[model samples]
Structures are given as C-alpha cells and as structure tokens.
Target: MSIVVIGSLNMDMVVRTKRAPEAGETLFGQEFALSPGGKGANQAVAAARLGAEVTMIGRVGKDSFGSGLLEVMKQEQVHTGYISQSESQSTGVASIVLDEEGENRIIVVPGANVEMKPADIEALESVIRQAGIVVMQLETDLNMVEAAAAIASRHGIPVILNPAPAQPLGDELLHQVTYLTPNETEAGILAGIPVESVDDAERAARILLQKGVQHIIVTLGSKGALIVNASGSLHVPGFPVQAVDTVAAGDSFNGALAWQLTRGKTLDEAVRFANAVGALAVGKAGAIPSLPRLQEVKQFLQEAAEAEPGAQ
Candidate 1:
C-alpha cells in the first residue's frame, strides 16, 4: 500500500553511556555517533524497506544534516519529492543518551520541524488525498498535524496518529484519527492515569475511547502491545530478543503496521508483524539503521517458528 508520512525529520546525535546521569552529575563512557531519525522519517524509511511505497512530507533546513537525511531516505526507497527545505531554519536535532541496557532518553530541538504550518499541509493536499494511509506524529506543529488529519479525513483515508513525546491531545484531533498509538507514558498522560501494566493500559484505553479515538494501541516495551477499540480489546505478545538500542522500535512497529494494513492484513495479523519488526529494531542500534527489511523480518519469524513451534 502507498503510505504518506507527515511529520518531523531530525539528525540524531547519540551518546552511549553506562547509565543516565542524575540531576547535576555527569558521566560518559562509551561512544557517540550521528544517525538519521525523527519519527516521520524513521517510519517512512521503515515502511519503504518493507516494500511499501512511501512519501515523506515534512520540512528540513538547507543544512548538512538535512541533506544527509534526504539522501538516506532516497537510498531507502522513500520518495523525497514532498519534503521541503527551509532556508531560514536550521535542521531539527535529537540529542539521545543511551545506556548499556538499550534504554534511552531523548531531548529534541524541533527547529525546522516546527516551522511547518497548516499552509504546508494544504499545499500538498493532492498527495495526501492519494495515500492508502496517512501516518502522522506530534513532533511537528499540532495545527499542521490537524491539517493533515483533516485532509485525510475528507478523502476517507486511514489516519494513523502516533502521539509521542507524551502530550495531551484535543478531542477534535482524536476524532479525526483512525488509530492512536501511544506508549505507556503517552497513554498515561492522555488518559490521566498511570500506565505500567496490561491492565493499566486497558483502563487507559477505555478512557481514551470516551474521548472519541476510534482505536487505541498502547505499546508495552517487552510486554508487547494492547489493542482496544469499540468492539473489544486484544493483546499481542512481543518477541524476545537481545536489545542493543531501542531508539526506533515504535517507529518500526508503526511502519510495519501501516504496510500490512495497506496490504489487506487483518488487524491482528498486522500487529503481530509489527511486533516482529519492532523486535528486530531493538536488536540494532540507531533509528533508521535499526529498521528491518521485509526479508529480514520474514526470516526472523521463520527462525522463531522453527525454534519453538507456534511461538510466532
């Protein structure tokens, strides 16, 4: 299925350390490197690698980081025609700190990402109207996100909203989305409750359901994902893998889910495939570098099946 991602593009500067420092203390030990990231670009490249036709619609600065990000997306087979360059703004950046256990903390500077306005979404109306599914996130301006969602809604396109960075959302936006994917922290914020277990996630989803979101998916790191909709709720188990860095795991899941849904997979089937993609992502290090290709995911699942019959 053809997918369109409307979100942010960032240059990720990653630092690996033993563990996160305290309020005033500082400690560093491992390595530092630059990577291509931003939820939008990560998801786009992910679905593209999985054989979906994806177009990225976002703004980037006319800087080295922006240039590299565009180059990487093209290399991954994601269409870059819709991405625009902002001469006045510098490229967005994400400062990430990673611990030995693959856990991470991130601080983002929206930069050019936030420069995108509703006009930008209107300018690309035709492109968005043609998509099988339109994927979005909170890295960009809320108005722009709402604009794209409105366009997708007018055309009856499926809209997937990955509300990250844990912010409160309005009912208008929630009603416009077909799917709302939020991690434990994000779900907790949206539902006004603490979320740490499957039960907590389910309760939070129920609260969100009252707010008019069509479907709610709460991603629970190693515990897997819980899906809640008007009809009912279901939990899909995650695969066990040695995680190196879990930077883009959720992005991989969203990408894989969108790709599968576009290809006519049932919601359950898509979630299972996404779980595999996310597992593979956590096994690797960076954002874009961690996303698995179609064959890799197939093989991963195949091996899992062979190792433990019916495990996958």
Candidate 2:
C-alpha cells in the first residue's frame, strides 16, 4: 500500500531557551538550529521512515531551502516526483521556539506553500488516484486540500485530514475525510468549545462529528488521543517519555496512523501504534531527525507491552 501527502515543504529556524519569552521581550537562547520541516513534509518523512511507500505532492521555492528539502525527502525515501518548484515565491519557513520543557511555539511563513495553484493539484490527479490513502494538512492552500480530498474520495481512497493551524472547514471537505486528526486546540476551534481535558476533547470530537466528519481523532499531547465516530468513542493512552521537543509529535502520529491502516490494522490498533510513534518523536529533538524507523516503533511497542502485560 502507498500513501500520498499533499502539503508544504519548509526550512525550520529553531531557537532554544530556558523558557519562552513574553511578547516583545528578548531572552538569551541556549541554541539555534535549522531543520527541514513542514506539516506535510514532516508527515511524509515520518511515514517513509516507518517503511511506507510515501509520495509527497507540494511546492517549494527555487532556492537553497527548496533544494535541501527535496534532498532530505529523497534521503528518507519519500518520492519527490510530484513536488514542484515555485518561480515567484521562496520556500516556506517556520520560526520555532523550544523551551526547557520541550514545549514549542511556532510562527509559519507559508511562502511557496500557499503559492501552489489549482493546476498543481490537477497535475497530480493520477498520482492521487493510485494511492491507498491520501494525507493532507492545512499549511498549503485551502483549494489544494479540497481538490486532493475530492479526488481521493472519488477513488474510494481513505483520506486523513490533519487539521493543523486550526481553522473552520466546510461540510463538503469534512464529509470526504475518513479521519479528522486534530490536536486539542485545533479541535476546540473547529468545534467551538474549549478543550481542557480528555472529556473536553471527546466533547469537541462529538461536535465535529455532527459537521459530517466520518470520524474524529482529537490528539492530546502525552495523554494520548480520543476517537469519536457515529457508533462510539475510544481513548488510546499515550506512552511515557521525557519530551525533548514536542515539534512533529502530531505529524508523526498521523503518519504512523496512515501506515498502520495500510497494513490492515484496525483503527484502534493503528492509533496505538501512532501513539508510540508520537512518544518516540517527542523524546528526541528536531522534526524529521526525531521520527523513528519501523523497527524502532515495533521494538518500542514490544517493550511497552512487556512492561504493561497487555495493557499496551
């Protein structure tokens, strides 16, 4: 089975500090680094590292960042044939700040990500058609997301829409999504409720379900996830890990979820695997650099199961 990711490519500029600075206040930072990251690219790399045949469909600027982004994708074995170059826009970038606790604050500059036109989506029709699953994020143009989802829905492919950078979505897109993966904050905005706990997350998921989403998964960092569908809801518990950086934790979960589904795992099973992937991702620093390989996840799960004696 194969997965197609319709999203963005970016070079992340990251800074580390003891604590996040208040607005307009400058603080001394512990470190600074550059990483290839974008919600779409992160998901693609996460899936590829976990042994999935993944293809990325997006655009990048004609610059060094774009070149580096493509090279990293290739190194991760994510197919880059569908990635395009933007003549008018620079590659997208994200400014990220990580604190001592590994929490992050991000500001995104969409750049070439939003510059991708409808024609780009149209050009990838055939590629999307053959995919077992189609994954998308909100970093790219809204039209691109809808266009890809429409095609995937038409082909009977399951679509996993990770609604990051939370925004309201119409029913047409919601109805086409097989699974809507949103973190607590994103879910709250879509559902018009403040999500403060697992129970609150479920309430938000239920509200979104009425908006025509087939199933909704509300991701709770370190607390696991809440899945609500027409029939019922379930909570997939998270694994314990000392978080080094929470960046890409949600992206890793989405990627692992898609890969496990391709292998015929049940949604419940898939979410469990996804949780493990997310745990591992937060244990390391950086975005793409932190995603674990397939074997690592399996071993992590095995050890988890041994410790919990089937509770895993």
Query: Model 1, range 1-312, lDDT digits (tens) per residue?
Result: 599999999999999998999999979658999999999999999899999999999989999999999999999999999899998999999999999999999999999999999998999999999999999999999999998999999999999999997788998889889989999889999999998788999999999998988889888887789999999999999898898999999999999999999999988889889999999999999999988999999999898788886664
Q: Please, what are the lDDT tens digits per residue for candidate 2 over residues 1-312? A: 999999989899999999999989989999999999999999999999989999999999999999999999999999999898998999999999999999999999999999876777977789999999999999989987888888889989999999988999988999899999999999999999998988888999988898888989888888888889998999999998999999999999999999999999999999999999999999999999999998999899888888986573
Candidate 1 lDDT (Cα, whole model)?
A: 0.93
TM-scores of all predicted structures: 0.98, 0.98
Q: How high a TM-score does candidate 2 get?
A: 0.98
- Report residue 309 deviation for candidate 2 (angstroms): 5.4
The stretch of ten residues in a row with the least summed lDDT in candidate 1 is: 303-312
In model 2, residue pairs whose N, Cα or C atoms come closer than 3 Å (at least 3 residues apart or on different chains), thus clashing, are: none
Error of 2 at 301 (Å): 1.0
